[model samples]
Target: MGLPKRDQQYHTYADYLGWPESVRYELLDGVAFMMAGSDLAHQDIVGEVFAQLRNALQGKPCRPFVAPFDVRLPKPRQSDEQTDTVVQPDVMVVCDPAKIDRRGIRGAPDLIVEVLSPSTAGHDQVLKRRAYERAGVQEFWLVHPTDRVVTIYTLGQDGYGKPEIQELVGTTPVGVLENVEITWDELVARLPKIEY
Candidate 1:
């Protein structure tokens, strides 16, 4: 069953915590958007990215996480209730240990990776993109599973500059982490071809 339409209502992290655990949501500017389950190919891609990051970042202070992880994005000086935005990117890395807690991340992560799904592509590219920019996330990557491409956005002095898009080939370097690289050749061998 679909969730009730609450587009006209505003929500927050406190409200989010009280909701039934069975349901999942991503809040954008206090508006609740229920999340959908990812498909096989999507999961395959996500798994590969996370696995690569895990091995590459070993012995490093930064840690990587997969989705279903709550990332609370509060505005400046906002408390739990006052904070209205949260999301679960497919893969993320938190270099600053202070930002992580038992619940999840309390602040912006140094890097985030979102594998684009057809239904939520626009939300990831536009709404969440702007939110990440505002939260001061240093880097964001949009991975298109079916399209076999990745678009990277690095936050600069004036917000995110023009994105750099790359075809899924060769090795893609992690901008925020030094000596860490994602091997596309191996990922391609494992990823199933997903149609757009």
Candidate 2:
């Protein structure tokens, strides 16, 4: 199915909190973006990665959260219902306790992960990259299940810096998150083969 049309109006996290769960969306630069669902392989990949991150983060100060969790970016002086924009990142880690809110995360997360699908590949690479950068997210990971590759992008002064691509040939270190590493083979083993 296609995404919802642009409403030509900007919204905040509070506005999104009132939205129905049927409408999947992400807010970027004051615009609402409908996030498309992914295929089985895509979801499996994300689940595997999320599981790994969760297991590894045990005992650490960081906490891992899966999608469908609202991540709100609030505009200045805006009420929760007025300027709060809620997004569901595939995976995220919140290191700061203060940013956690009853509505969701109100600021940039320590790490954000997006599993790429055909329709969203470009948006994740470019559009979402810019948005996450502008939001000051420390790390972003783009997972391409078809290619059996994962690209880790860390936030830099200008924007998201060059990505480190790890092919599914062997163990690949996730350089962005400290003390965390995973292999392409490990990630690939979690998903069924793509028939197409």
Candidate 3:
């Protein structure tokens, strides 16, 4: 699917807050990108990933949140109107309690997961990845539902290091989070079978 037409005027978090909640969007460098609804497979993967993260984070300080949760990436000392970027990752694990508020996350999350959808794959892989890296997200995962593969990126001194690829065959340890393992085969088995 194609992206929404570019608006002439740049948008801010204040403007985003006032927009209708029925429609979903993300602001990147003051530009708005409309978000498309996820399909069954995408939703299933998101749910499973969230469940796994949630289970691992149980009794821990870090917490997992699904999409539609605002993650405002603001510059230091910037107000809501001055803040331009606001994104909603498929699943985010925020370790800082201070960042959690009535609105949403105020800064970068510890880990972000973006499950690929046909409409938003490009943005997720390129634009969002760069933005997340710039915002200092520690770990980023790009999950391809159709291919049943996951590409993990870890932030380093220079930026994100080489991506570590993992196929959805067996259990794989989540590198960023200690002792956390995702049962890939179980997740794939539980996904709803779709016929084209």
What are the per-residue Cα lDDT tens digits for candidate 2 across 1-196? 2345358788766566667878788876667888887788877777877788888889988888998887775556655566534568898999898988776787789888898887888777887777677778888888887887778887788777777887766655555557776545755775655563
Candidate 2 at residue 152, lDDT? Answer: 82
Of models 1 and 3, which has the larger TM-score? 3
**Residues 23-59, model 3: lDDT tens digits:** 8889988989988788888888899889988988999
What does candidate 1's lDDT look like per residue over 1-196, in tens digits? Answer: 3333346789989888889988888888898988877887788788988999999889989999999899999999999678899888889999889889889998899999988887878888998999999999999999987778999999999999899999889999999999887878767766665454
Candidate 3's error at 7, in angstroms? 1.8
Clashes of each: 0, 9, 0
lDDT of 2 at 86: 56
Which residue pairs collide, candidate 2?
A: 12-83, 12-84, 12-85, 13-83, 13-84, 13-85, 14-80, 14-81, 14-84
What candidate 3 gets wrong by more than 4 Å, as runs, is 190-192
Candidates 1 and 2 compared: the better one by TM-score is 1
What is the TM-score of candidate 2? 0.86
**What are the lDDT scores of the predictions, listed in order?**
0.87, 0.75, 0.88
TM-score of each: 0.93, 0.86, 0.95
Candidate 2 residues lying further than 4 Å off, grouped into runs, are 1-3, 75-85, 190-192
